[model samples]
Target: MKRLHYFMIVFLITGISYAQELTITGMVTEDGTGTPLPYVNVTVKRTSNTTNTDFDGNYSIKVNLGDTLSFSYVGYESEEIKVKKNDSVINVTMSIAPGTLEEVVVTAYGARKAKKSLGYVVSAVSSESISMSRSERRKARRASKKSNKSLNKALSGKVAGLTISNGVGYTNSNSSVKIRGANSVSGAQQPLYIIDGIPVNKKDIAKIQHIDPTKISDVKVLKDKKATSLYGFRAIHGCIIITTHKGNYEIKNNESYEEIVENSFEKVRTSPLSTFSIDVDKASYSNVRRMINNGQQIPADAVKIEEMINYFEYDYKQPKGDHPFAIHTEYGKTPWNKETQLVKIGLKGKEIPQDEIPASNLVFLLDVSGSMDQANKLPLLKRAFKLLVNQLREKDKVSIVVYAGAAGMVLKPTSGINKNEINQALDNLDAGGSTAGGAGIELAYKIAQKNFIKNGNNRVILATDGDFNVGMSSDKDMKTLIEEKRKSGVFLTCLGFGMNNYKDSKLETLADKGNGNHAYIDTMQEAQRVLGKEFGGTLYTIAKDVKIQVEFNPAKVQAYRLIGYENRLLADEDFVDDTKDAGELGSGHTVTALYEVIPVGVRSEYINEIPDLKYTNSEINRNFGDELLTVKFRYKRPQESKSIEMIHILKTGENKVSKDFSFAASVAWFGMKIRKSKYINNDQIKDIVTLAEENRAADNQGYRAEFVRLMNSYQTL
Candidate 1:
């Protein structure tokens, strides 16, 4: 999906370039003084497509053989020209009529776009000024307080209505955007960001998550309600259009495998893993023996247990250490103290390069719901797929299945390596009807199965707002149905679109049950980052039914609980039993998890002063320093029938403290404080921020500055 998007710039630009098309190149000038009309806008008529004249009023445009071109400038009368297959260049001298140059401006409320165009927003960024910043100073406002003092300085003057203010840190989380000022105070106001037209997830917007911005060519902000209406409800907060120049518009694929090759780290523990024992909550099973051992009470209603659990926070351990590339870590600071600590880990072993990843059969299950008429939903879906189409290799295939009032195939299994045919299919998509989500999923899966990849990635990528109101609507029923199909080897990746009817939970179910991942496409940069660049991780699967179990040592830790991954927990028995299912892992993907531990001596609310008499017969206490916990992982080889297990012990005080983990812990701590999680202290935000900054590393240091900026903006709170 991502690779195709990068390819589209090529497909869209050159897609017509090689189409036996006509090139209309000429110089515009006044008939008398022969003065150049610099910056005059030229449009290819019927299509609101356009570009501007250069300083010398020289212009070059690509058009189909029989298309007509239109020309306009602030003070020039607009002219139209028709071109044919054999005509190469066309030149014209302008005769300006008085008052003919009235500028056309689009405005409605606080939003603005040229009334001359519609479909997607005209959000744009200067081509010559593109910069590579880890924490993309999303707003022109103060990205860092130390450098840009005023909040307005970071992002204010640059993007209209796009404000990037808050504190001075990487994870302020509070910094916000109100595209047209509070459309709905209760809903997310961040505009839908379309890169070349695909929606990207908001959480993936940080500097280090994924995608290299250096590959990006331009950015467009779709702000006005009109600009966003293509996606209907999702555009309540507006939208952004991002176009990566990888394949289109002459942006060379600048980053080589070596350059984009992420720095690697040493595994904190890589010994041959040990096996784990399973433990299920008493009520979760029907195993008569285990039930009797625990003396559990039976329930009248069926629990209808999931065959395999697809929880999100199994805390896969990354190889923790400084990058072997440059050794970025400070000698004294442990992994636990750095503000923006990055545990750069690559695949346990190379599977395949991005370009060389296996052929895939992709079925895009799109929801063209009534709520999706706003700019970001259906429209972005088309744009995003077009971007994905641009990246296809000869072996890749694509199929699009759209559902709203009824389900139907817009395009069959066609090679993504092919463009025009796919674009024609995409160009015809229109949004209407109630969401018949379940029907769409069924059709998509059917299409994917028809083009199923043998020993490759075969998946249905569902893009929708998840409002399955029309038929087969219950989420659980849909989940159960999808789960059964995943056994057939067709994975799923759920892409959520629209805001008012956005169902994160439902999309989550599909991704989990269907052996895939969920990402919210809120921007095009995100789409490029995901589909164009990280195509393998986005498409290929290396491991399936991945489960992790951490058994804490009761002796060393008094009380402890994992945080955030409420959805990812596994019963201990499920961890070892080959038959029990778990989450799937993509090649070279990184998953993180954290735990808030209350050490043995820090007694307060966690411990019960009086022990329960039920356990009075316990033996004498032993060593408390052996191990804090043993980390166990169970997963099926990307090419296996059963699961395999690996285990490592994580002892308390075993951390050979690196500033990276400490800083990351601080950042996560900041998030806990911001979201006001149960364990974090509001009063301690300042201290945590200070700790993160003080422990920050010198390598790729911009993230630290961002963290500081976020802190400054919210420290007052």
Candidate 2:
């Protein structure tokens, strides 16, 4: 019946490529300030389709007349417009409404219902919440990583039940979010994060296109059981419905940026970062003695690099940037949202080209494994990869390779210039049979080698769930094979498809050894993120073998542990060894890491312990203090066989007057509170949210603004 319907629809619509000329344009704003607000929601009356205001406070949607449009945003009144004519531009202002965090959302079968009418309790975290949290952390995650934004040290108690793990350090690769204790144990326990009606898994973190939080306008969370039950087993962990705010304007700079930043305040609710500051010393560490006896070295210098970096205290300014997100919200209520936490969020950050990114010659190797039968898996993969295909340039080229019971090459090398053919190939793929992943891999590499774009980005994109049960299945043996293959001028980027028994352990090694990136494609939007938005970073390689080693002075410090990145951790010597496998980076990408310091002058337990065994060489040079921690990176031009090195010198100082000092720490607290790890005590979620609230950025992306509301809604449960 479905096929018949589709056939009839296709037959009837065959000659209607150019249906009609109709235009819809409008401006969303805060009712109170008469501010042209960005991220106000706008949706098609009878459809799930939606769009948001751009940074310029304008939206242009192309649709036929007679379509009813809905408008909504957190802390603002909602309105609807009827499209009755062509070329109409309607400007609208949305007023702030009390208890606005509560908004309606869609769940399961695309139902619509009011927030006040639902029988079950649900919470909506709009894009606003995501933007707020992203802002506090973006500064630290960017280059130079030198500046303080805002944040409190203790974030555990701030939100009612949100737990914060240890608050010692902050790392980009590590995500602190673990919803309501460890539910999955080994598998992902995080509540599914759905963006634009697409479900995404936690592993998608690495694939995130450095989306400016400022571009996002709002978000809505689904926290109730019945509300999420429609997703079946997957929703047992709960759901977060993210609504991104956008505008359809063409302004990529100042005009839209300033307006969006000002409009963000209409929903701002708390002040935090300025609420308090804590002093730490060796005496503060509870287990300095145990840490020292275990043979850990401490820094002798009074300055703590981790603490200083953790709070964004450096002089480095944000790089040049452009907001790419376009958000739209509808005025009417969604099917769910019994207790929605309507959040408006966005990422407003800078992007700097890594010197110059290499051109790319990519072979998209897909595994049509039978395991990819779920909606969020292979089906979404097709849509997402198409988004990336649309963004390629003439200099880039793409090829398609797939494996099922047998391996085969689906599409030969095609010019990235021809998006139509690329998309056609992607759309034609189907999933069936057991996975013969290895054969497909070899074929992809051979193709990549055959058409190696000299001095450019040459890599194979392997998309799969990492389930390689047939042929070349052993992890140890596979490691050796990848190592041998990596020596070729070709690099690899492993894109994981689907979840449920995802082989993360294998995918991690493959990408790390092949000197590429590991990303999980859980949704079509993420596919756009990994392929289109970050084409340069995802397909090209600028830097490889990136490593960091911090040597603490036992005299000044007693004990310290890394905050996160348990997976990316490397030996101190590995920092300089080019042969050892390490992490790779793309153009215009930023990585951040942080640590907590216990000063020497203060009577802290962390620095009080003495080593049972003396050092072999007690004498040290004067440069020891200058070399607290060394960040060394070795990389070859994407097409080169050997590698070169780049170095950054880091020195720490204590200062209470620095703004850059606290902001990075604010990011750390946000991460800790989200993960609920055991590293932090006496910390609360409320305090962290409060800190983020206070340290809102001059150019907020709706992140901190929304975080305040999510923290508040946690109380309703």
Model 1, runs deviating above 4 Å? 1-351, 610-617, 620-624, 652-656, 682-717
Instruction: Please give the lDDT score for candidate 1.
Output: 0.55
lDDT of each: 0.55, 0.51
Residue 207 miss distance in model 1 (angstroms): 39
lDDT of 1 by residue, 1-717 (tens): 889997987778765654665567898887687976655667786563555664456788878876887776544556777886667777767776563211221111122346456654454565445553445544322333233322223224556566654434433333455555525534546665544433444432322112234555655566655653454445667765555666232212111000111111111122112222221111111111112222322121111112111111112334443210111111122123222122211123123476767888888788876657765567666766777778777788888898988899988888876788888988887775577888888888888887777887788888876778788887788878888888788888877654434565576667777778766554343355456765666677777776656555555555444434444555555666777656766655554444444444554443345444563454324664666566656667766878766655654442355555555556555544444444433446668778778867763424354445446545542
What TM-score, computed on C-alpha atoms, does each candidate reach? Answer: 0.54, 0.55
Top lDDT model:
1
What ranges in model 2 sit over 4 Å off? Answer: 1-18, 21-83, 87-358, 367-375, 465-481, 496-506, 520-533, 553-555, 601-611, 614-649, 652-661, 698-717
Q: Model 2 scores what on Cα lDDT?
A: 0.51
